[model samples]
Target: MESIKLHQFVPISGEQKPARVPRRKVNGPATAALLIKMATEILTASPTLRHQTNITLTDLAAAEKVRKALLKTPLQ
Candidate 1:
C-alpha cells in the first residue's frame, strides 16, 4: 500500500489587494456651487461652437442657469 500527501499553496508576499471605497456624493453648498459653475459653463457657450466647452467662465451666475441647461430631462 502507498501513502498519498496533499500539497498546500501560499500566496506570494507583497501582493496586497487594493481596498475599494464607496463613493459618497457631496450635497453641501460647496457642491451646489461647483455644480452651478459646471452647469453655467455648459449653457453659456454657443450650441454650435467649434471649440470644446459648452460653458465658460464668461457665464458665471447663479444655480438657475445650470438647472435651466439640464431642463426637465433627467441625466442619462
Candidate 2:
C-alpha cells in the first residue's frame, strides 16, 4: 500500500493565517487507514475545541477496542 501523507493546519501570524503542516505519513492496510481516519474524526468532533488539551482515557480505550476489532476484520 502507498503511504498516506496527512497534514494539519497550523496557525500563523502572517498574511496566510493558517499554514499546512505535514503531520505524518501512514503506511498500512485499508483497515488500518480507515481506523486512523475514524479516530481523527472522533477527536476533532469534540465539543470543547479551544480549551481541550487531551482526550479522555475512556475515549482512548473505546477507540483502541474499535481499532483492535477493525484489525481483525478483513478489508472490503
Candidate 3:
C-alpha cells in the first residue's frame, strides 16, 4: 500500500500549520467518471466553472491527458 505525501502548510498564530489533505493532481479512471457524473451538480452549485473553462471529459484517457497538461504547464 502507498500513502500520499503532503505539502503547503499554512501559518497559525506565529507558527506554520498543517494544510488540509490535498486533492490528487490527476484524476484517475474512477475519478474521471465521478467528476463527469458530478459535474452537472457541481456546476449547478457553482456556476463559476462556466467562466473558467468548459471541459468535457468522458473517460480516463481524457482525464489523464488533462492531468498531464495541467502538471506540465508553468506558472506565468
Q: After superposition on all CA atoms, what RMSD does each candidate show versus the true structure?
A: 12.7, 19.4, 16.7
Q: Order the candidates by lDDT, highest first — what do you get? A: 2, 1, 3
Which residue segments of model 2 deviate by more than 4 Å? 1-54
Q: Write the per-residue lDDT of candidate 1 for residues 1-75, one digit (tens) a residue.
A: 999988888775787766889898644555555676565556665454413544444445545655555454443
* Winner on lDDT (1 vs 3): 1
Residue 40's C-alpha lDDT in candidate 2?
Answer: 57
> Compared with the true structure, what per-residue lDDT tens digits does model 3 show for residues 1-76?
9999999885568566668898767635445445554665465455466456664334434655665565555543
TM-score of 2: 0.33
lDDT by residue for model 2 (1-76), tens: 9999999887775676555898775435555747765765666667474138567656666767776676776644
Highest lDDT: give the candidate number: 2
The 10-residue segment of model 3 with minimum total lDDT is: 55-64
Give the deviation of candidate 3 from the true structure as CA RMSD: 16.7
TM-score of each: 0.31, 0.33, 0.25
